[model samples]
Target chain A: MLVEIYLIAVVVALACSLPGVFLVLRGSTMLSDAITHTVLLGIVLAFFVVNDLNSPFLIVGATLVGVLTVWLIETLQHTKLLSNDSAIGIVFPLFFSIAIILITRYAGNVHLDADSVLMGELAFAPFRRMTLFGMDFGPKVLWSMLIILIINVLFITFFYKELKITTFDPGLAAALGFSPVFLHYALMTLVSLTAVGAYDSVGSILVVGFMVGPALTGYLLTHRLKRMILITLITAVFNSLVGVKAAFVLDTSIAGMIAVVTGITCLLAFLFSPSKGSIQAIRNRWKQRKNLKKQAASSHIKS
Target chain B: MEQLLALFSDYTFQIVALGTGFLGLLSGVVGTYATLRKESLLGDALSHAALPGIALAFLLIGKKDLVYLLGGALISGLIATALIQWISKKSTVKFDNALSVVLSSFFGLGLVLLTHIQGLENANQAGLEKFIYGQASSMLLSDVQLLLAVGAGILVLVLLLWKELKVFAFDPVFTQTLGFQTRILQFILSAMIILTVIFGLESVGVILMSALLIGPAVAARQWSDRLGVVLILAGLFGMVSGVAGTFISSIGRQIPTGPTIVLVLSLIVMISLIFSPKRGLIIRWVNQRRKKKAYIKQIEEKQERSEKYAR
Candidate 1:
């Protein structure tokens, strides 16, 4: 059972980390953070209308709202009235607050568990079963996670050139006949989609870890975007597996434990990665200082 | 109208009003630095880190004294911040990760202690938990007085170090070369940030306190380029949000103050994001349109001039 859980976790982590790589590179980290918060409104609103948290319409509604959040923030950012980060900071929290308000006003009248929006249930994920065409399949969590992974893979592959060009040099990309704006929105939509769907299993705090941690750890390992994406996928999968099993053994909060473990992995990568690791960066500086000191000493001795 | 007037006359609303007002002021002033540094998450992290310090202070001192507990919280938050710094320095961990580790550990420790206290069924624990979400309605006049004093002290410190802080923020290397004690100044500023978090944690609860610190500054940044004005404006935004949230919660029986304040503060930030003069999105769109029009006009005139010359 534990082995199955770990396998599922690996798949889940890899899928979420795919879009995270691009989101981090485009400097839309905060948008992803904002989307994670705003999804509560989407989920609860969908629940209010559909009366079922388990319905697939919840994912659709959340994704659509998440896309709207990205669009609104982009529109706001273009105005130059506020910086991009501040615009995101403003939009998502207000949406989240409204969601919280709706919950308080309408609690117990509906089954929209507001607390579940904060800390998702990763351990109990294996229990939620899915049904296909006349056969009782495995968990719904696994199926939804698989569906997101497929979408992420397809999108990343199809728009690989557009995304790469847009991320690196929007001006050059525009000159070369690609609309950076289109690609930017596309990327954000995918991020929000994946994040909103993924959070149902991983929770808000751990979603960020999956988003940034793997990409960051991969960044330490390589500079090339392709390699970074691949490595980030691996790192995220490993992190999720480690975090879930550790939580099971430790008997603590799964989401919080995953976040802490992600932090630890990032720390490890920051320290020991061959090039530009924190310790390596510091060592080079020290070596440069020592060389300078030696040159000064040699000149003095000669004199 | 008479009953509303009586509410104003009562002591509870007065105390609640004053305490939140002081918190609003401190949050606005300190939040400017957080937004500028782009470490807004630090606001959230530090608040959680202060939780255990409050519980520990109560445990050791056997008193629920706000000042004493706040001091303990301040010290512990600083230590957590320091530990995050040290770990980032000495090890390979990234800044965000270090923050994550410290925040969770401290919060988890606090949770354990709190649940233990709850199990003990101690009478003192009775309203102590209220600090987490902040029940400003339950505050006394003494609490209000302490808040005002702390708020005043923080404001003075911000004024005293305004020049140094600005230089450090914009260009630290230049400031260092110009003979400023960058480390001490930074340490002091960072300490002030933790203090701000600790102070707001009492009324906003540790989890919700970051909204107070980060929200107004974000809104203020949209409206102005001058750091000083931005700081002041952020403070004003905080004051408005604080008062508004408190008022709504007081009038509405079931609404919690912290979430209401955060929601209200968040609304101001959104308004600034889209509508604030030069930085606003609508104005930028207009500017781009105008610039494109001017460029087209210039091109047309130049072509006409060339045609005349040819003739």
Candidate 2:
């Protein structure tokens, strides 16, 4: 059970971290945060329509709403009324608060509660079985997340060049016949799908954590995009394993523990990354100072 | 109408309404500078950061006293802001990334501590969870008193330092050239923001507190460009939303006051965005359409004159 949980967590982390690299590089971490929260409304609305949480319609609805959120924010941005941050700050809370109110008033009797939405229960994931034609999958969440992970991997692999071009130089990419706008929405759809898949196990907050934390850490450690991706994957898997173990010992929320670990990992990289770490910079400065002092003393002695 | 009047007249409703109104007003005033500074999300970060402070205070003091909890929150919020400032300053990381790091880590710690508190066999721990989404209905008179005092203090401070703060907020280099202690003023302004966030936590919760901070300011910005007018309008908008949300939530058994207030604030923003005089979307659209029509008309007139001359 523990191994299954750990694998599921790693897959979820990988799924979030993949798009997260683009998001962080594009400086859209806050947009991911917005999508994570607003996607709740999508999930709840989908539940109302399908009358089941397991329906794939949930992912479709969430992706639509996620795209809508981006569109609304972009529209607001075009108006030149509010800054991008304010627009994000405004839209997500409106959608999220409405979702919360709906859940409390209308869905109180249902299993869709705010607590699980905020602090998802990973421990309970193992007990929920997915049966497909008399075959038992260990956990339903695991299979769903695996599917999402595969989709994310395939999407990234197929469109690697396009995504890279669009992400780094949208104007150039457009000039080269790739539609940056289309690619942007495609990436957002994948982000929303990944968020919804991870929602049941790690919740929204950890989804943001997984998205930004490893990506930022990877960013600090490397300059190359490919190397950053590799570093992010390693960081994500390592953080998940450590987080699960810490949660087991502390008997706390595994999702929260994972987020906390990811944060710590990022901080460590921020402080100690060989290329860009503050501590490294400081040490180099100290060394430079010492060398200057020695040169001054030696020159004085010669005089 | 009578029932509505009676609801307003009720003591508990009056307290909740007054407290939230003051909270809204305070956050509005402070949030203006925050929003203009592009630190609109700072309130979100600080509020989430305050969670661990509240939890730590309870654990250390072995009680859930409001004052002590708020004190702890204030301390932690300041630390979080300071860390954000430091990380952004000392490292190559941008401000947004630093904000994200502090926000998530602190919030994650808060969650872990909250779960730990829950595991402990203490009935008082039940009330602690309310801070997450806020239980405005559970507010007592004493809490209202604390809010009033803090709110008034912040208002007075802002009033006294209005010139310095304005200069600093608009242009720190100019303020420094004027020999103003910009760093001190910046610290004080951050302190005020942190205080407003802590005071609001009991009502707005950690999750939606930033909306209360940013919503009214954004709404007010649509109407006016002047700082004074924007601040005043933001305060008025916030007060209206706060009072109205309180009344509406009081009317229903299931409606949550915090989210209701946020919804009301968002509604105000939407209305202001659409209908405000200067920068409203509708007005802008109208102006564009008129300009296009006039341009086309001028072209047609020129064409007619050219044809007539040729004939």
Candidate 3:
């Protein structure tokens, strides 16, 4: 059961980190945050239709709402009324609050609640088994996340060039016949899908951590996109394993522990990464001061 | 009508309504500066950072005293803001990244501490979770008193430094050149903003408090460009939303007060977006249509003159 929990965490981290690199590079970390929250509305509306938390329709509904969230944000941004951050700060809460209100009013008798939406329980994931043909499979969350992870990996692999072009140089990509707008929506859809898949295990808030933290840590360590992606995966897996152990030891929310671990990992990279770390910069400043002192002493001796 | 009057006359409802109204007014005033400076999301980060502070305060005091909890939240929120500034300045990381790092980490810590406190068999821990979603209906008279004090302080400070703040917000370099201690002023303003966030957190929760901050300011911006009018309009909008949200939530037993306030604020924003006379979408669309018609009319008249000359 422990191993299964670990596996699910690892898979979730992988799924989020893949798209996270793009989001971080594009400077849309806040948008990812918005999508994660508004996807709750999609889940609730879908739950109302299907009346089951485990239905696949939830993911589909959530992905559409995620796209709508992006559209609304973009529409507000294009209005030149509110800044990008304010647009995001406005739209998600509206959608999320509506969802919370609905859940409190209509879904009171059901399993859906606001607490689980914010802080999902990963420890319980292991007990919710999936059975096929009267044979027991592993945890349902692990299977679902595995499938989503595969989708993310395949999507990233196939659209590697397009995503790279669009993320770095949208104008150039458009000039080269690739629609940056289409790519943006496509990426947003995938992000929505990832959020929906991970919602049951890690909840919405931690999804932002998983999506941004590892990718950012990797970014601090490396300059190349390929190397960044590799570092991000390593960091994600490391954070998840450490987080599981920490949560077990502390008897806290596993997702919260994971987010906290991801934060620490990013902080460590921020302070100590050899290429771009603050420590290196400080050391260089010290060395430069020493060189200045040595040169001044030599000049005095000559005089 | 009688029931409405009775609801307003009720002391508990009045406290909740007035407390939320003050929250709206304070957040609106501070949020104007934040929104104009493009630091709109700072409230989000600060509110989340306050969670750990609230939890830590509860742990240290071994009780759920509102004052100590709010003080702890204020200290942590200040730290989070400082860290955001420090990281953005000291490293190559951008401000948004730094903001997210501090927000998620602090919130994660808060969640961990909250869960730990919940397991401690302490009776005081029962209401700690209310800070997450915020139960304005559950607010005590003491909380309302705190809100009144903080709200007055915020209003007075904003009034006292109104000119300097306006100058500082519009152009910091100019403010510095004019021999102002721009850094001190910026620090004070940020502290006030953080205080406003902390004040609203008990009513709006950490997640939706940013909306309260941004929503009214955004709505006011649509109606006016002047800073003073915008501030006044924002305060008014916020107050209206606060009262309406409180009243509406009171109507429905299960309606969450925080989100209800947020939704009310959102509704105001939507209304302003479409109907506000100055910068509204519909108004702009109508102006564009009129301009197009005039341009076409001028072109037709010019064509008639050319044809008459040719004949």
Cα lDDT of all candidates, in order?
Answer: 0.75, 0.88, 0.90
Candidate 3 residues A164-261, lDDT tens each?
99999999999999999998999999899999888879988878889989999999999999999999999999999999999999999888899899
Query: Which residue pairs collide, candidate 1?
Result: A79-B280, A79-B281, A80-B279, A80-B280, A81-B279, A81-B280, A267-B93
RMSD of each: 4.4, 2.3, 2.3
What value does the lDDT take at residue B306 in candidate 1?
Answer: 100
Model 3 superposed RMSD (Cα): 2.3
True contacts kept of 1: 0.14
- Return the TM-score for each candidate structure: 0.82, 0.95, 0.96
Interface RMSD for candidates 1 onward, in order: 4.4, 1.3, 1.2
Q: Compute the lDDT of residue A147 as modeled in candidate 3.
A: 87
Best by DockQ: 3
Docking class of 2: medium
Chain A TM-score for each candidate, in the given order?
A: 0.93, 0.94, 0.94
Query: B1-311, model 1: which lDDT tens digit per residue?
Result: 88778877777777787678778878888888877766666777787778778878888877788888888788878888887787656654456555654665566445445545655646777666665556667777887777787778878988898898899877878999999998887788788788877777777775567778778898888888899899989999999898888878887876767778888888787678668787676787789999999999999999999999999
Return whichever of 1 and 3 wins on TM-score: 3
lDDT of each residue in B1-311, candidate 3, tens digit only? 89889888999999999999888888888899999888999998898889989999999999988999999999999888888888878887878877876788888888889989989988878988888878888888998898898889888988999889999989999999999998899799889888888888888887899999999999999999899999999999999999899999998788989999999999999999999898899999999999999999999999999999999
Query: What fraction of native interface contacts is shared by candidate 2?
Result: 0.56
- Residue A129 CA error for candidate 1 (Å)? 2.6
Span of 10 residues, lowest total lDDT, candidate 3 chain A: A114-123
Order by lDDT, highest first: 3, 2, 1
